[model samples]
Target: MTIATRRAQARALFDAGVAAADPVAATTRALVQSPVPATLIIAVGKAARGMAQAAMAACPNVPCLIVTNDENAAPLAGAQVMAAGHPVPDERGARAADMVIAALEGVGAGDHVLVLVSGGGSALLPAPVQGVSLADKAAMNNLLLASGADIMQMNLVRQQLSRLKGGGLLRIAAPASVTALILSDVMGDDLRAVASGPTAAPLGTKAQACNILQSFDIWEKCPRSVRDHLSGVDTATDIPRADNHLIGANPISLRAMAALVPDAHVIADPIEGDVAAAARVICDAAAPGITLWGGETTVHLRGTGRGGRNQELALRIALEARARGWTAGWVCLQGGTDGRDGPTDAAGGLVDSGTLGRIDNVAALLANNDSYAALEQAGDLLITGATGTNVADLGVLIRP
Candidate 1:
């Protein structure tokens, strides 16, 4: 197949993966027989608007509150859409948390509260525990992100420092039934890691949180409130477990992509750790037809490079392909299911045999972590503009 066809096929596969995780369809299917007698729809994360819109369709007059990132914010009738920061907490996100808490507070015994949880929910709902300011929480989050800590580890630390996380929201909404429709972004759909388990119980402890901070050597640099909160004695939060439904996830999207390509094989496990390492794993195993991988990757951000993990991974793959001179006509795509990667507007990057030919300074671009610019120059950047869903990142490798 030609390079153009390979690129189109890769993007088509990705779009299929995203379509499989559509929040509207997923939410509608989930609520078909579920008992949400009276819904105070509280949707949080990147896909909050779409999820909330779906819930509203099911219940026309149901009151809804959408806490989502700015890029994904869309106007929905009968719903209050509040834009919040993701990957980091901010003052606006803090206020959104207050509004979310307020919406959850009044659900009586006869009411049903539906919480649409997706990726970035933790940061989007930045309700710091008493005595912790938004700036303090944001600083701690930056430390966690920079520390190369896994999502679970970072969430463990975040849950300990948040007021509405770690089952805090469920506790306040008690005496009423709560159903959380979740879109899995973290590996294993570990509720504790997905948005810091806002409506779910934390499987970790404050001691673990403290250790992570110290292990990262950011304990001293962390905000005073974070240090104080972690140092304080643990208090038991006895909250009823909200019904968490895994509406969609990375695996779900991966399966969809796999079905689209003949002989496509899916890596059962999602990729993790450093982006370069993950890129190597995919680059070293590009088979004919399709090879699918799903999972989130981390970037150490050494240089002032502007790119997300997916962009970084794709660029690294291109670099590796150039070094090894992998089989001709092989194309690979690496992008987020949420349609936004890191600080750039592009979702990810698509790399082929010809991708690096257009640029002489490929190594420099990769070194500076500026894969977005490099990908754009090659016309390989994947820009889908907010797919209205979050199921982590999905990758496709095509060899023809």
Candidate 2:
């Protein structure tokens, strides 16, 4: 078999995984027979549009608001749609969050607030707590990203700074019956971390947020307002009581993919490690079957690499396969569920042993943080534009 053949098989398995964890279909089915009449639905994140479409199909005529990345605007035709920046807060995201807060204000005691929550919501709906500017939040976020902090730690810092996160949105929808349908991107499906748990119960302490920043050596770079907010001098609002449900996650998606591909092996539902090291493990272990792993990874960003975690993982894995004298008939893929990796337009990369064999300066590319360029030259960058969904990172290794 050729590298192309292996990649094709891996792609099929990945698509199967996504189909199995369809947030829209799953959420719609869950809410179809509920006796409570949903008065308003706010769907926020990469999966917002799909989840909103499903919600509308299940319960027609309900007022709906969909917030997603700017690139996915066309799918949300009938709803009040707000396209915003992601992975970092921008003015547009803050504005959308204000709209969501206003929408919550209209909910009556018995009215239903159906929230479609997923990854990227934290950045998409950036309603900062009083006294924090969008620029301030953006700087903090960038600092965290470059510092190699994990999602859990990053979200803890974000929850403290945002009025819509850390269950603050639940407080805004207080007295109303809130039902949150979540498409989890975080490991363990920690509801409070997914989209910063806008509609879930608050889970972290102020000290925890401060510690995360301190550990990353970013406490000084954080905004003054953010620092004051987490210092406990002023009391922050708490997450309100709401019924939250996790509709989809990496485990579910990886399991679905495993079922589609015979002799499949799941490396780990929550794979974690140094990006390059993890790549070496995958390349060494992949056999004559499909291997799946799902979870977020951290990048230290020492090099000026124009690559995300998934892209870097692919490049590293390809290099490892070459080092082991492995050629053709093996494919490795790493991609983010949100269809964006790092600050690039790529979802991730799909490469083979042949790719490494062709590249002469692989080390230079990796050292320069130019995995995107290297993968592109090797014809291995995976480009799915935007999938309109985010559950985390998905990696597939196939050997034939």
Candidate 3:
């Protein structure tokens, strides 16, 4: 097959993957199939609007509170839709979190709280624990982002810092039958880490937070209030056990993508660490057939270049594949299911053998962390604008 055909096939596979991970269909199916009547629907994250609509369809007239980022905001009938800051929290996020707490308060024995949890929820809802201010939390978040801490580590610290996380939400709605419908964004679908486990269980401790902060070399940099709070935090007791269901995630998307390719093999190890290393590992493991991967990767911003982790990883794969002198007919598409990568308008990047040859300054672009510019110049950037469903990122590699 020609390189063009391979690229087309990869794009087709990505489209299929995204369809499988769409939160609207998954949320409707999960809730409608269960046939549970929820008293209140609390949908949080980038997919909040979509998930909230699905919940309304399933339950038909439930009161809802949809908290999401500005880009993901949409109108919902009879639901309070509040737009908040994302990838970082603000006062609006803090208020929305308080609203969630107030909305859940005073629930009775049989009322069910249908909690829709998805990616970006952690930033969309910011309820700092007592003694710690929102500014402190934001500073720590920026620090963590700069430190290249993945979702798990960032959430481990976030869970400790927030009053609404780590099973705290479940605790607030103690007697109510609260069931969470989670769209997994973090690796391995660890509920405790997703959205810092608002409706799930807590797996982190204050000690762990301290260790993480110290390991990141930010312990001394942390605000005094945050340090004091962590130092004196007690092991929370009597926290309610978590009952959450997965509606969609990266694995689900990967499965749908795999169905399009008979010989597709999904790599078991999650794509993590630096983008170049991940690309090398994926290229090495891939055979003369399609390979599927689902997970989020990190990009430690070396230079002030434009691109998300997906774009950088895609470009890295192209650069590395050329370095290794792979024969032609190889294509890789890496993109976030949510259709937004980092702060850029592009979802990610698509790269092939042709991509490396198109750019004379490929090394410089990689060094400057400017895959966005290079990929855009090559007409290889994937731009799909807020997909209204985030289940981490989906990657497809084709080797012929």
TM-score of each: 0.96, 0.94, 0.95
Error of 2 at 9 (Å): 0.9
Better of 2 and 3 by lDDT: 3
Per-prediction count of colliding residue pairs? 1, 3, 0
How far out, in Å, is residue 320 in model 3?
1.1
- Write down the TM-score for model 1: 0.96
lDDT of each: 0.86, 0.82, 0.86
lDDT of 1 by residue, 216-264 (tens): 7778998887888889898896778688888888888888888877588
User: 252-276 in candidate 2: lDDT tens per residue?
Assistant: 8888887776578788637776797
lDDT of 1: 0.86
Tell me, what's the RMSD of every candidate? 1.5, 1.9, 1.8
Where model 1 places Cα greater than 4 Å from the true spot, the runs are none
Model 3 vs. true fold: TM: 0.95
lDDT of 1 at 150: 84
lDDT of 3 by residue, 194-266 (tens): 8888987666788888998898788999999989988985775457755689888788788888777767889
